[model samples]
Target: SVLEGGTWAAGRRAAAERRPGGGPPLTILSDGTVF
Candidate 1:
């Protein structure tokens, strides 16, 4: 699932960057595209 994968990646990146709320987490629509 793109959403799950993206969100996981985003969380890792955010943690590495030390920015808990730096921006929105990645999301995916029914079309399997990030939104």
Candidate 2:
């Protein structure tokens, strides 16, 4: 299922805060996929 807008927005905000420089702010090191 897709994530809700509020949840996704919050995640983006958290990611931005976590990586303010913003090259690739978020990374999910799975087999070969990321959101």
Candidate 3:
């Protein structure tokens, strides 16, 4: 589950980077939690 979450987060980050004019900032906690 941890690996899957990491993969999903990475994919999301990649997609966000592809957005035009930049994407909103992401807040990730030290525990791997994102908001």
Candidate 4:
């Protein structure tokens, strides 16, 4: 999942830079159909 790789992949170079505690990105939107 992109979420796991981008914002939730701790200690992974493929992950995006985030806050110290793995805070979510500022802009994300989805209906009730996805995670």
Candidate 5:
């Protein structure tokens, strides 16, 4: 069960890496509210 869970987690991480914009980017906000 633990091994299966680990494999699933690893697969998800690999898929995320393959995405075009896989992670957040640097940004600046003049106002405190982002919305």
Candidate 6:
């Protein structure tokens, strides 16, 4: 699961905490691979 405790989850948690809506802190590319 994406929620599993790992580097990805760590970063996700960081993003969630940084943003108001739990969204990424940066703008994602239209290609869907830049975030």
TM-score per model over all chains: 0.47, 0.48, 0.54, 0.20, 0.54, 0.43
After the best TM-score superposition of candidate 3, give how far the Cα of residue 16 lies from its true spot, in angstroms: 0.1
Name model 5 segments beyond 4 Å from true. 21-35
**Off by more than 4 A, model 1:** 19-35
Model 2 regions lying over 4 Å from their true place? 1-3, 21-35
Return the candidate ranking by lDDT, descending. 3, 1, 2, 6, 5, 4
Residue-by-residue lDDT tens digits, candidate 2, 1-35 = 35676777776666555454543523522212244
Clash list (residue pairs), candidate 2 = none
Please say which candidate is ahead in lDDT: 3 or 4: 3
List the pairs of residues colliding in candidate 3. none
Writing each residue's lDDT as its tens digit, candidate 4 over 11-30 gives 34223333345545432222
Backbone atom clashes (below 3 Å) for every candidate: 0, 0, 0, 0, 0, 0
Alpha carbon deviation, residue 23, candidate 6 (Å): 10
Cα lDDT of model 5 by residue, 1-35, tens digit: 99988976875665555445633322212211122
- lDDT, model 2, position 16: 54
- Residue range 1-35, candidate 1, lDDT tens digits: 99998987876654545434443333232223332
* Model 2 vs. true fold: TM: 0.48
Clashes of 3: 0
Model 6, stretches more than 4 Å misplaced?
Answer: 1-5, 21-35
How well is each residue in 1-35 modelled by candidate 3, as lDDT tens digits?
99998998887676555455454444333324344
lDDT accuracy of residue 21 in candidate 1: 46
Clashing pairs in 1: none
